[model samples]
Target: MSVHETIEQALVAPSYLAGGGDPGWVTVPLHRACDWSYGHDPLMPRVILTSPDQQATLRIDPDPDEPWWTVRHARCGDRPAWSATFDARTPVEIIAALTDALTAPTPPAPGLEPYDLLRQAGWHTVGEGLISPGRIAAIEHYGGEDGPWFADARLDQDEGGLIWRAYLSNTTPPHLIAAFAQALADPTPVRRPVGRVPAPAREHTLTRTVHLPVGDVAFALEQRVAALSARRKDATSNTHPPRSPRVPPPRRTR
Candidate 1:
């Protein structure tokens, strides 16, 4: 088979495990699979499947020139939480591996030690273990808006763990920090299944015969550009809060 034909066949295959509607498995759009940045790559033929909670995204990008496909596990953002490449496997085996990887419990957020989770969650890190001006601003802003709820808010290290810190203060309510920590840790809640579930559908399929040298490669290239342009537009237009995975709650020493 031609390279394009091989890639298309693989892309169209059912690569995700089947499960119930919610708290189960579902297919996500190609653009939503990984960051649009990855889809923009000319040589990577990509597809993605996501769990209902939006906590996990499984990305499959087949190398056009090679026999293997690169699989990535991602959270809500563009960066993959984990990744691996598979070769000498059928589409079924690839899907099984993808399922195993996704269903497995996620490890701690990548680089939490060097890259502070607080900094990643929109709090700025200042010198000598101080909070950033931006982080203080955010705290103050939220504190003002939230009233007495945030009055005593301050960042404190989780008792023995270095992975997380608690927002604590004498007057600040415990739940306040608890909720914030939860939100920071599991930013993407498990998405409940939506209504009237349509059977899972393939977002893209090769309809007619596509010759490799001309039509298929050209089409793939066009898709890459389109995906890239869309991502650029999103980057320019949207102002989104930084996200972090659910970290262990700060030790409640209060």
Candidate 2:
């Protein structure tokens, strides 16, 4: 149906494959979402999703031999869910489904400024068209009018399948990063046979790690300014220009 639908279907797969009957998983929203570059390959398709409750992450892989794409689920929260596989012929449906699902009934936080949303959602803002290779990514604090991060994706296709490396930076709780991870690990239909495997055009393995602080830089600046002001006050007497008062003529009372 949709990418979101596929994920839900994949997640809610009959559960019979594992064992006897169990309560099937009902549909749910995808609170967060992201996408990355994926060229045709038989192995891993670069697409993934994380649950709205911050509970689980899902990955879809491309499988040539199987009827359905393989799906992996990692439950971050207390609930234990096993990884399974499913099919997705068209990916647009799945992506749209996720967008719709994430837009569901959850109440927006009270007085959530854009910054708050970005922080809680773990996202970053990046300048438009600034993505490139081998540059320390440029990003602002999460939730400002300007974004905190952007990604330049590198894709490689070999005899095996597609492999993707995305240089990501963002102040928004790194939600896009999480989405990338989820998408990479999630299964997808093998659009092309594992072409001739080449030396990975970019040298890196399965994962790339980035360490950056996330949140409001402006807020930090404000705090710093306040601190400096207090220190300045502490260092000096209140010796600015003294106030001058004008005396009015005595009232000619009766």
Candidate 3:
């Protein structure tokens, strides 16, 4: 079968359980996990699969110049945490790796200071335990309609060194939320070296302009005219009442 057919079948196939009765083994939609594009070139196909926790991602995309497919596994947005290359013929091996990644345990969340944790949670920290204008705006936006219930957090410095206060959103998973809560309560300061701010995410816009032959263009225009005429006729009919039957027919019958 063709590569496309193979991938489609794999997607639709039953979830591959790593071990017997493992509940974590769940089927993930290809679009949600990967950055696969419908318009990607067939010669250099790409596929990515992310773990359920959003910690790990597996990518399979061959470089245009390279003959082998570059299969990479990353954790916490770290690209190529682990990687390997395979010949074009070995798609099965690549699929196996992706399946393995699905069941793999996510690496522990990085140790973060109280101030840094707030920043990671979509808050902007201006000074020590202080909020930024952007963070205030975010809080307001989150409390508005179509926003999560747990919108903002309150931080203060009391007799205790630092006080972090936040309510858990109903939407937040219990286990993950508890982890965050525990991390915030911990007294130990962050030991890891602070990493530089990551660059903003790249945005892509696709524009396609189709050039049609004269014959096709003319046909399209004719169709549009017909559609408009039908619409106008319907509108005119709706605006006016139906005409009554003539009384001459009744007189002739009499």
Candidate 4:
């Protein structure tokens, strides 16, 4: 059966035991435990479904000049195991191939992994079969290798919730790790959105549930830290308030 079938089955099937409540939405959480790999680039890779529709591919090309980027290919209708390549710049034509493969009226395999599930729910990427375990495990969405790296994307039903692990690799500063860990632990956005929303307020909650894998979380942390550092040069040029002046102490007794 395809992933759609599995979802249908799960919907009617009795809820199974899991960490979070309501098996109806538990798939998002359990999927987080599954592992996915990434390239050394500071950003999350772009996922492309291959033509001929064999496996889902996560590709990261940090250097456009380089022949190849990192590729992690996972077969559909199979368990989470995947094959990875450090350098392989794929041709642009492959995007069309992937789109055709996924947009097909019927998928060769019915049951899809988490990556496919999110796509079926209306999420779109550059390619088909391009679902990544990280994408599905966590509801991460971005364009190209360049990113707005999200640490955790999650969904909740009646207070029950699921969390993703969206971490990146090769980080130096420690606070950045804390920031990601903080985001993961506290998905709340006590802070306000920096920009304006073109649309009127909808019933949607400010917070969302993204089921990112733990491996992805580490990767996201790295990306966030690096991005922060890149801004430091510009930030240092700005001015700051000096330390508060201290008042003089009263005279001591003789």
Candidate 5:
């Protein structure tokens, strides 16, 4: 199909996790905000972003056939290391929240605790996990000398198992973890059409049909693209100014 035709078709059923939205919502913003080195495979259309320190990596692969590993993040740290993966259907909005949290320059907000944040957000303990108010989602947390603490989201479960999940590693800045806590805690209903989402998801996630405007998401995405573009423009202009003779620092001699 022609590109124009494809765009029209997507407009009719533009729903979160329905496979029509662009992953750039998460990738582009994070790239510009964190200044991660970016690489792409034009043919397969995959995006791989590596942190400047090379301690973290984010990969977004949208191919539905490869659902086992769609959006993945990994960080290598001192004592413990961790990796997070989400299925192909996971919403970019949710992932963006975690990445957005990482953009903050300050240390983790005062008095921010992941478990307490979850509890305040209406989740309660169930043995080793914390179940959401809707009971469709749960969290598995672990910590000790062997491993650092982490709160993982397992959402939209039924007989089919974990529908989609988000793993934010403990090493992944504490403030970012708090960002995720706020994201998952948000009561805002994700704008997804009933038929477009998974059957199991609808069973537990069904709620009042609140027709919400998704323009904010679209606007935010456009803003990210513009911001990234402007920053790159400034960088390019600065790097290649008219002409300035290069001078090396005097050689050090012992």
Candidate 6:
């Protein structure tokens, strides 16, 4: 079978049990763990997810020249609109954190200190950004107090190359950034295919494949379709009331 088939049968997993850093780590939960409406096309290697309330959206595209993941929210009440972006190659676990936080049932508490959040997650100061315990990933702040936030995984090769990077405007909610910090500090290894994983993750010992039945995604999609159908049926019924039974002219006795 093809490499895609092999990946579908059994997912590359880290012994630690957390999701592997593959793009699926972020994609699966957005559908399985949240109530986002999902859309995709086989002709395209991307997925678009919209919030149930229609106030927010998430997109995943693996094109190397463009952002891989992007989240945008519409202004609601007192909450200001915002956006977050992740470049291709960004660790899947990192992006997953932001999604989990974004879709949380309850809004994240306000007034969180970014520094404290990172500290709580066990990330130590390394100048502008904090480094992961494994020292493979790093999240930095640049452009002074008003600059955007960044996250990247890098390797010190012959010339030192970056594995991936992510950006978040300073206006991004603090809660989302906090979630990112926690994920960055997590010691668990993310799952990844033997040949397709980023160079940084591959430097570590790999674990056995884990069964992530593809049925789960299908089931989630089924639920979404059922919900949409029910809503549409209700709408149609309400708009066009049933017609009264037709009555024949007084018996054709004539």
Q: Write the per-residue lDDT of candidate 1 for residues 80-111, one digit (tens) a residue.
A: 25443332222232233234324323322333
What are the Cα lDDT values of the candidates? Answer: 0.33, 0.30, 0.32, 0.29, 0.56, 0.64
Please provide, for model 5 over 26-68, each residue's C-alpha lDDT reduced to its tens digit, 9 standing for 90 to 100: 7776676567788766787677888767766777666655443
Candidate of highest lDDT: 6
TM-score of every candidate relative to the true structure: 0.20, 0.20, 0.21, 0.17, 0.63, 0.64
Residue 205, model 1, lDDT: 18
lDDT for each residue of candidate 4 in 1-254, tens digit (9 for 90 to 100): 23222111111000001112211111111122111222343355443323224444444444444423233335344444333222221112122122223223333343444344445544445342232222322323244233323323223422223222233322212222222222222222321112221121112224323333444433443553344344443444444546679999999998
For model 4, give the 10-residue run with minimal summed lDDT. Answer: 8-17
Write candidate 2's Cα lDDT for 70-181 as tens digits: 2233444563333333333322223322332222233223344423333443334345333212232222233433343222123322323322222222322233233333
Stretches of candidate 4 above 4 Å error? 1-153, 156-164, 167-173, 182-254
Give the clash count for model 3: 0
Could you give me the TM-score of model 3 versus the true structure? Answer: 0.21
Instruction: Rank by lDDT, highest first.
Output: 6, 5, 1, 3, 2, 4
In model 5, the Cα lDDT at residue 159 comes to 29
In model 3, where do residues sit more than 4 Å from their true spots? 1-45, 52-54, 62-64, 75-80, 91-94, 101-254
Query: How do the residues 1-254 of candidate 3 rate in per-residue lDDT, one tens digit apiece?
Result: 33222111001001110011111111122332222223345665565555444544445554544423333335344332443333332223123333333332342454554334445544464422334332321122244333332222212233231111223233332233334333323333211111211111001111122333445433433553354445546656877879987666554553
For candidate 5, report its TM-score: 0.63
Candidate 3, after superposition: displacement of residue 126 in Å? 60
Task: Give the Å error, residue 59, model 5.
Answer: 0.7
